[model samples]
Target: MANAIWHQWVGCEYRVLKTAKENIVSQRSASPVLSSYARLQRFILTALLCWTVFTPGAVQASEELHYALTVNVNFGQDLGQPLGSLFEVRDSQGEVVLGAGFASVYNTMLQGNRHELQLYLHGDRDEALEISSLPRPSPAMGTFITAYNGELLANAMNYGSPMVWDSASTTWREDTTAPRYYQTPVASGNLVFRPSQVEYQGRTIFASERTTALFFYGAGNLFAWEEGESDLSKAKVHAVPWTPDRDRADMDHAATLELATSSAFPYCYGVLDNEVLMVSNLGWLYGFDGEQWRLIQDNSGNVFQMYTMLNVYDRLLLGNFPTGGIYAWDGNTLEFVSAPLDYAHSGMFEAQTFALYGGDLYVGMWPWGELWRYSVLDNEWNLAARLFSHPERDSDLLTPYRSLLRTEFPSREYSSHSLGQRVYSLLPLSGSLYASTSARSGRDGRDIFHFLSQQELDQYGAVHRITAPTEASAQIRWTGEPTTFVLEVHSDSLRILQDGVE
Candidate 1:
């Protein structure tokens, strides 16, 4: 703690400059009386102009980026099957080689880095898959998703209880040595904050429950941590070399690193300021500085519940519960960024997911599947659109069609619960935004599809164009012959002021 310090300076600094208004008036005026009046007026106007331009309170209006909001694709219709949770896997070229769903994963055939849908095929629906270390030509299963009772996808990789999915055998093998981990659903009153992956000393490390796997490069050798003891200060900490390809008998003994922390199960993980950060379900923020873990920030138990955490401009932004507002920690205190978080149903509709597109934060809500945009520059939030991508038929046309039918038909049923939509996932693929929805009604019912592009955002509305005044002039006709005077704009400056005086 001796090395950490929070700096605070409440005062602002400003600068004052001397202008040449008197010199300009003397040079431009022919009569002394006119020159005197002109000089006074010019001096007053110059002072006001400078104040208007340099004042700290003067804020420039923010600009909006356009996006073409449209339904590019529908997964259910395309596959002729219902969809569940969706995940993305990238190839060696960094292109999406596969789109994995809870029920099945689709193989994306490519033509020079672009996916050619004609050659696509679907894989096992019930099988859960996680990408292997080297995701090239194809991705091997490194983990599996299991619903042990009521548990949801607790790990950041979106799986529970770490297990390796052997592609050849098509079976999930558990890591018997790792400590047991459980992530309760948010609706169940507890948050599941799991560490996804972090880059440490050039190697990628992912933690599932208490088990930590360190992967190396090339014909790389993998490693794992030993089962930690109950001691918070001196938990077991050692590393043993292990190879996944070798026989289970040849697997080396696990080593451990006695990381100090109060939170027994930590799920929320992020990297900030070159440090690996972890947030526990208990609301404690821990940072790892290459050597040991240190508790950097902590909120009272059950006081500050974080729904989603994101990194924007290198700083961590957390979507908090109850308030539904976004908060950022600036190495010291938390700064709240206000938005219209209040929906028809309060905290029930929390921001479950977040994505940064075109400098704005797109927040996807739970249960409702609504989308909201937070203007980073203006510090405001607005209802961008809805996730329920269904169109209603006009009664006038439907009435005639219904009468023309000889036999009775099944009419569209309307119910409150039946009309609900929930956004299960929000992904930014290529130049568009792909969203997956779980709805009971509408075209989006149980659909895993739709991509919104910049063109769609542009179609939403035109951005207001703002331009500086290009010309400045004055009139002079004291010598009988009419003369038009042109004022030449020179330089501009700004200063932050504490008070009226600089």
Candidate 2:
């Protein structure tokens, strides 16, 4: 019966007997019904094998996806915190495809506490990748962060450490070849880099902070460090002093003395065509000509106290703090542009907004991230967008966000450090936006959060959960595309997958 069943399964192959002996052997071994069943089985197996050989699987290749990385700084009781805890996404060749960090914060903290954040990129496959922290510097103050020109390589500053990202070895090496003159110890206080430029001695210069004073370092010279190193050592540091200077060479000496004597030291400074334009906190505008400084305008005697200034198209656009009023500097005179809303105070601590894009002026207001587009032809301010924290708002500020930093959208404003878990800085990289939060959360320990693209958030949800600990770490991935993708959040891992596969 078993032989009959096998032959029946075999089907047509059993009918074409090659020899009488074979047929006789089959007859002796199997019943007719069994042979027929065996033949059928064999025929079915052959057809299935042929069909499988010709047909392909149904699944298709997944779409390429991008992720924005958000890192949260969690300080523990032990001062021995790690430095340069970088969260980087690399390609199969181990080349850094995207990277970001709070450069200003890391550099500021590296001198006092042994806390550091180091993120290294590893792995070449699509499998589970491990992200581990690097060792902390001994007696570390805190990790200070800085990014490459494009924010591709986010770096941490420790004393005597070099700054080099090795693409071949897939590592960051200390830049030992950097001229000794270029190497300066990280400043010892809270510092932020501004995009202002100054002109001195017929040369354009840029200033960055060292402690309290702004160091006027010349621009356009890659080897400017030779001059900076020499000048920095003998650099004459000035404060908004209130004491009258005995030396006449100090342009601000008298003003410093006055500020010292008086209760107010009202001064605002901005970069105007390679010149450091100083507006007294009391609203006086002066032009520093690199050697001697002279007063250009005294608005303290007028109606406005200049909080921020931007030189646009040979005209100066001045913003009054607390109040959302604006003024224009047109060569020979200052003209009032507009005033704040009725309910808004002109003196509230607000961030000044001046970003030049496509020949138009983009001005952002503090507290509320309201963006306005300034038209040069009509002399009008148009409501462009308002950055909001909520996802349901009608504002287009968070949609189709583009940045050079590839981390977070640059439109958002960060709250002060005292405001825990708030954002502090916004960086734009490779058409993506990146931001750093004030601190980690107390519950889930997530200190940072990334708002996914509007399209993705709408398709999924506003908050795409990554592997950020509810308490300590914040993770964000930039989906470089403008389409929808999946954010897979698990306790042990987080991945941004396209079409449900990673």
Report the number of the highest-TM-score candidate: 1
Q: Identify the candidate with maximal lDDT.
A: 1
Report, for every candidate in turn, its global Cα lDDT versus the true structure. 0.30, 0.28
Worst 10 residues of 2 by lDDT: 1-10
Q: Tally clashes: model 1.
A: 20
After superposition, which runs of candidate 2 have C-alpha atoms over 4 Å from their true positions? 1-147, 152-211, 216-268, 271-275, 280-284, 296-307, 330-332, 339-351, 375-385, 390-502
TM-scores for candidates 1 onward, in order: 0.35, 0.34
Per-residue lDDT tens digits of candidate 1, residues 111-172? 01001011001111221212112111111111112222221111112223444334356444
Candidate 2, residues 1-502, lDDT tens digits: the string is 0000000010111112111222322442243222222222112111100000000111121232112222222221211111221222223333332221211111111111111111111111221212122222111211222233222222322235534434356454565433211111111111122222222222333343432222221111111111113422422223221111111112333122122112233334433333445454456665543344466865554544654544433345666655667776654566766653343453442324443321234454543444455543234566544433433422222222223213442444432221112122222222122222222111121123344443322221011111111111112222222222232212222233322333
